[model samples]
Target chain A: MNLNIEVNNNVLTAMPGDTILDALNRHGMNVPTLCHLKGLMPSGACRMCVVEVEGRKNLVTSCSEPVMDGMKIQTHSARVIESRKTIVELLLSNHPDDCLYCERNGSCELQKLAEDLNVRERRISGNKNNYKLDVSSASIVRDPAKCILCGRCVRVCEEIEGVSAIEFVGRGSKTFIDTSFNHGLNVSTCVNCGQCIMVCPTGALKEKPHIDEIKTKLADPTKTVVIQYAPSITISLAEEFGFKPGQNIGGIMNAALRRIGFNFVFDTSFSADLTIMEEASELVHRITTGGTLPMITSCCPGWVKYAEEFQHDILPNLSSCKSPQQMMGAIIKSYFAEAEGINPADIYSVSVMPCTAKKFEQQREEMTQNGISDVDAVLTTRELARLIRLFGIDMDKISPELADSPLGTRSSAGKIFGVSGGVMEAAIRSAHYFITGKELIKFQVNAVRGLAGRKEAKVMINGLEIGVAVVSGLKNAEILMEEVRNGRKDIHFIEVMACPGGCINGGGQPIGTNEESLRARMKSLYEIDEHDAIKVSHKNPYIIELYDKFLGKPLGHKSHHLLHTNYQERDVN
Target chain B: MKSKVEEILQQYPNAGRDSLIPILQSVQESLGFLSEESVVQVSKFLKMPASKIFGVATFYNQFRFTQPGKYHVMVCRGTACHVLGSATVLEEIEKYLKVKPGMTTKDKIFSLEVVACIGACGLAPVISINGEFHAKVTTESIQSIFETYRNREV
Candidate 1:
């Protein structure tokens, strides 16, 4: 069903399903859009796309309005321009005029639109809405005053990523996006995925600033800053520095870190393998003892935070193990520091991750084991890019190198931890080995592998069908939980990560990744998985050596003291 | 909606003042307003005092205890709204009502609320007075729309 619409002295043809803006864009008419994210549907909130309909008495938002046959529309009329200019002026009035100092100054859509619309000044005399900047968490910053409330952050959290931590609070002039009950991100149900920051047009949302602090510490001669990279960071960090998506610069990354004056270069994948040993054993213990049904995986800090907030009723079901990063931090301070005969206080631990939530997770009071913060500071993949650019490291020419000893060496099981369902698969490999005392021939668990919202698999472990469910994104988790509550779900174990596609598609990774980018990155992860010799966590020499020398065994007295954690039921109010 | 409300109320016969907010929300969802009879029924259903329910209904701004005007006009005064010339829209609404925000005219034709952001910044100067979202509102449009609703009521 083709429709003909008269728009701006031109007759434009459109399909029945085409929105007015869609028709305009097809006809080479650019209707300004801000909140209409490509992956999501039209919100029609930003008035910049207002166009005059000939029959209608007033202008209609082209984004939401559908084009009909024989409809007369003016894409650029005097009234339409006036209306758009007014909207832009108004948006600028309340917005913080600090773009010169903003990190997103050159990249901001709002700034571009303001300039395009020729909004010179705000004629309306109004005081800026003052909202206290929130720096409660390590990963993300919340500057309420600069927030346009376009709901891109809210929509991204709820629709795409499926973590509904942010929502509209208060009524009329007082309305703002708030974490549950006006609490700080640290105290709220937010998973700290940082997707909100990714979609935010203004500087209202950002990774918590640590550049100055890191610089100050680097200037201190007494401090030994050791930098570590997550396995996923190797796959995505190149994109931020103008390299194509999925470019591997592991050696260049290490070189870049050394250039930035880091004393030691390590990998989180080493601890990732360690996490598999502990987590896999814990899963087996639960299965044998008839403990919490469907013991939840705790590799992702965002997922852990979500479990702490809305699902505290099922706290016992969560694995007692800390995240791989935290596990690394605790081990570095205790085992590695002691082994090297170095004071833990003098060792500054820095983790470069594809997760913003890791920052918030590191700040957990319980994470501090020996009077010092386990991980001193966390830099996101994007932050690492900034550092790389600051140091003028030519990423294209550099050769990929291996990470440092014991703590940096990783297995295929650890490398796969970057993708969704990888953690479950890794844990299963270790669990099989731990139970049978034999290496499993077929390393891959095909049942739990994919990008589906919720997946369930039943594995015949020694003739017993071990039920396991894998869910990515919090909304999917909610659906699975409802099924559990209603007695409809029958799973012995579950893996839940807050971000879509798990840590590979983390909130703190490089921005502007589309379907192609995701595919490319996913391919790189699987390639790493297929090439590695040590495919299981228990098979990793470092993990086996660590247990033999220091930790004794998984869930042992010493392991329990450092590796496990307890959760507290949060106040819902 | 009413049947669902009745069923929910029956499930919580021993509910006290704590159940007031949920009961009020359920009631509002059903009748669109917390009527006197519904409030009494809620009090009797929960086995709590009627005064307590009334007190809670009036406390939360979300509770619309009174009958709404024929045309509900909620002008967003949120930070996003303020930046988008919402004040001019508010003035236009006041001119039509001959009363300030949070008040209805003598004819009970329109009720107003200076609401926060409706999460529609793209179409700023938005108003969802009676559940119908009107975006990019101008001074002329507000006056003409008021007459349209006022004429319908008369």
Candidate 2:
């Protein structure tokens, strides 16, 4: 059912229920939007996509209005443009005067709209709402002064993430976004996934940066600063340096970190391999010894915290293994310090992650071993890029270099841990090996692959039926968790990554990220898994050597002391 | 408190998103205001997030999060009241009581509120103190109103 529509004096075909915005977008018409999230229900709050339709007196919002047959639409008429400009001005009149020092100074949507609409002069000015900045959360900061009431953060928090940690509070002129009872986010049931920060178009919401602390530590001559980056950062960091997305910059990233004054740089993927070795062995032990039936992966800190806060009943089900970042931190301070003969106190451990929750994870009391903190500081991928730029390191000109030895080497299976289903796939590859002592005939589990929100797969290992489920986005995870709560007994293993599309689309990734970049990042990880010779974590000689030398075996007494930790059921308040 | 909220919530069926506002209103009415415990209980009953319940409850003027004072003073700031300089009257009241709208006096005797209208437009610039309406209020008359409330027996 194709309907003809005249858009901006050009005839365009639309589907039966296609909106004018949809038809125009299909025809390559560029219309700006602020409150419009990609897949969520259309909320015509921003009024930025308002277009004039013939036979209609008022300019209807194209996002909400459906295209009628033979309807004429003008996307950018003088009247529409003026209305948008006025709206921008009205928003600006209430916004703060701190753009020069704002985190999203260049990337703010309100700032961009003002420039696009040529709103140079302030036509209207009045009393701006002076709300205090909320810096309570470990991962995110909320400044109500910069909020334009776009409701993107509120929607993303509730709709996409299912946290609903924050919402629109109060009425009309006094309306502001806040958690329940006007308490800070730290007290709220915020899992600190930072998805709200990623969707926020302004500097109102941003990752709580530890850049100053990192810089101070780096400059300290006595401190031996070491940094480890997550696997997803390698593929996504290239975008920050003006390179195309999915460019594997692993070696160059090592070189860049070297130039940025880090004494040592290691890859969290090595620990990711180490994680599979332990996690897979744990799953096998659980199946054989009548432990927890479906052991959930605890690699994602966001998911771990969610379990601690909301899903306390499922705590026993979570694999007792710390995340790869924490694992690397533990081994670096203990194993690496023992080998290098450096004092653990002097080693300032830092990690660059594709997540904001890593900051919270590193600070968790359970992550500490023997009263000494494992990781000193955690930086998001965005923060690492800032450090690179601050040091004036030319990423493109730097020659490729490998990571530091012993805790550096990793399998391609570990590298794919950055994407959704990769953890389950990697764990399955090793879990099969742990159970049967042979590699899977088909290492590539096509069932658990791709960008599905919730994925399920069944595999037979040594004639033993195994059911596995992979879920990303906490909302999607909640649906599967509901089934688990309802006594559904099919699944034997489950992997939950809080951010949608896994770490490739994590909250701390580059801003303005769309579907194309997400696909590219996921493809790059799969490509590494395809091309690399060592595809399985069990196949990684370094992992086997680590067990032979320091850690006796996976889930052994020594490994449990160093690599594993417990969770505390936190108050939901 | 838990038993009261549970009793009010038991009237609604097991699963319904639309029951949130009504449940919240009932809980607020029974408890005098929605406490953190009441909100959490409502969330458990309806299986809704507390943040969202707060979002809906804060939308209407009929609901109040804080407990009302013994002598709740609601000053009208409607179109007629505004034209008659009710803003000055509100300022005088705030200065005299040493409290702003949405805040109770330190003694807990008076709580100030700015309402849109009280439907007594013919008597423009009205201020209601504990169900008693004073029409055509002025900045000068604010002192006498507070005096009357202060001297009155509870």
Candidate 3:
């Protein structure tokens, strides 16, 4: 068989069995496609990648076709270009024309395709999309008006996350994506993870805006507005301000938040350290006292909701510690309110997170005391960038500033909670100390680090083997849940995150980012851990002070009242 | 009816994900239409999300959600019937019954549904009521046929 295929007067290497799209893509052909996700099986529903081939009756969809040896292919012939242009025009005809008001106006893939293809006019027209917008969920809004039916969100939700919250409901032209029985998202089995928002090409899916309420709070003179940011947002949010991906802009971010009318700024990672402290002691207590064996970490609100909806039987295995976002929010109202002489009612608590699910988690009935919610509002990384822009805070001109006293300082152990295996590693560090009263020879548990969806490691604390598993993305977590269901007793601890690669690449971070950027963010967290002097959560002075001054100890009564809560089985069926 | 659905699910002991279609078909055959509870039961049995099951079930015309009315009406819209003016017959029935295709009347006595073919080309413009056939129907004669079913006569 011939080894080469002619393309536009140039011979490119074409593997015998590779699809033409793959061959072209591999050899640096930048053919645009709307429905093709790199690793998934191509649906080929959209003909955007269609190419003209010699001796073919119609344009061949490059994504679905296998390359034949010595087959002549033209990726951008006049006919192919016209076909692609027509496809875009048709999609635009049905799409909403309000781009200026759209959430994805600047970053929309369809808008980019329209520009790249030089689509100048409405050459074709069709009935416009008049589907109703679904704003029932607190974390996400689904506007069917702008959906181009790329199926990316549906594919990722079903194939990767294994939560088919949305699906193509009808057939043919009547086809539209909907929840079960075309119901509202709130009643559906959606975990509010916002992975759908990350995959959506248009503004059809977006984080439910908390910006208006935040604006109201920021402008209110009576309310003392205090804000905290998640561990992952520090590194991942830098890219939103045109900084290099994974740049640690934590100090500048604190300064920016202060400029945006927040009276006080705090770091969520401090509470992450607090979470580790409570969670570690809880693990040791459970293991020693013959409580639940495989105690799952509950740092990720998305994973917690998923467990509540799908794996309700194993709710006993979940650690009752509140997530760092809620932890800091609760503390800001309770401990910080008392110390600063501010009433909990007057203090408006806000958190910036790399997750949309944090919005849902903040409003949980358990995360409230005396009708006062811990977190008043939550902003995604993208929304924070929008806020910074709206306030005209020049990130480049801003000087770095430290977070406020008492609730700000954190160890690298808490900071690395941005990554997937971070919680397990942090908890193990404190658990080892809590158990043996000594530090591990090395602070870094390298076995459970990096971008893998799942990782396992064994730890020896005084010759008692402790087996641990860390999984991000509910699909990966499903495997371990099945094992536990089938009575596998060897595993003792589990860490689950709803988004893959952890909060650094969470659904509420920057949209349309590649894997390389995620790797950079992951690498930055590890690097921070590597260079920091305080490697363990137990070593943070503020945490030790917090325990000594206010909360008596881990798993104490006050800690249970403030930092720990129970989860119940949520019926999704 | 819910217990019958559960019993139907139990028959397929090897009921995994792929067995969903057969289970859905069996349940629908016994119950006449798919119910919300049946879909949830199928979800539990197959260990799949109910949304996924609902989605797959809605893709085909063979599966339906609403329960059939006491006297289910089927108007054949096949090529032979359409050529013989079954469209007008369907319109008359819809007009008389005051319900569209796949919907039941408010009183629960009559249901109207359109089918592609009844395989009786010789008896063109045919409609079936509770599996009993009526041949060569028209707009004028349609109201009388429904009156006969309403009166419980042959």
- Give the candidates in order of TM-score, highest first: 2, 3, 1
Each model's TM-score? 0.75, 0.96, 0.92
Per-residue alpha-carbon lDDT of candidate 3 for residues A1-573, written as tens digits (9 for 90 to 100)? 546888887998887878889999888887889988877688898889999999998999999899887789999999999999999998998898999999998899999999999998888888889999999988999999898888988988887788899998877776789998788998888888888888888999999899899999899999999999998888888898888987999999999999999999999989999999999999999999999979999989888988998888889999999999988988889989999899999999999998999989988899998999999999999999999999999999989999998899999999999999999999999999999999999888998998888899999999999999999889999988999889988789999999988898788999977788999998999999999999999999999999998999999988999999999889875
Question: Which clashing pairs does model 2 show?
Answer: none
Scored against the true structure, residue A546 in model 2 reaches a CA lDDT of: 87
Candidate 2 stretches with Cα past 4 Å from truth are B13-15, B119-124, B134-137, B151-154
lDDT tens per residue, model 1, A23-42: 88887889887777765778
In angstroms, the error of model 1 at A236 is 1.8
- Candidate 2's docking class is medium
Interface RMSD values for the candidates, listed in order?
Answer: 11.7, 1.1, 1.1
Under CAPRI classification, how is model 3 graded? medium
i-RMS of candidate 2: 1.1
Please list the C-alpha lDDT of all candidates, in the order they appear. Answer: 0.80, 0.89, 0.90
DockQ (0 to 1) for model 2: 0.71
lDDT tens readout by residue for model 1, B24-105: 8877877767776676577557654344455455546777755667777888887777887898889878877887765666
Q: Of the candidates shown, which would achieve the greatest TM-score relative to the real structure?
A: 2
lDDT accuracy of residue A11 in candidate 3: 90
Clashes of each: 18, 0, 0
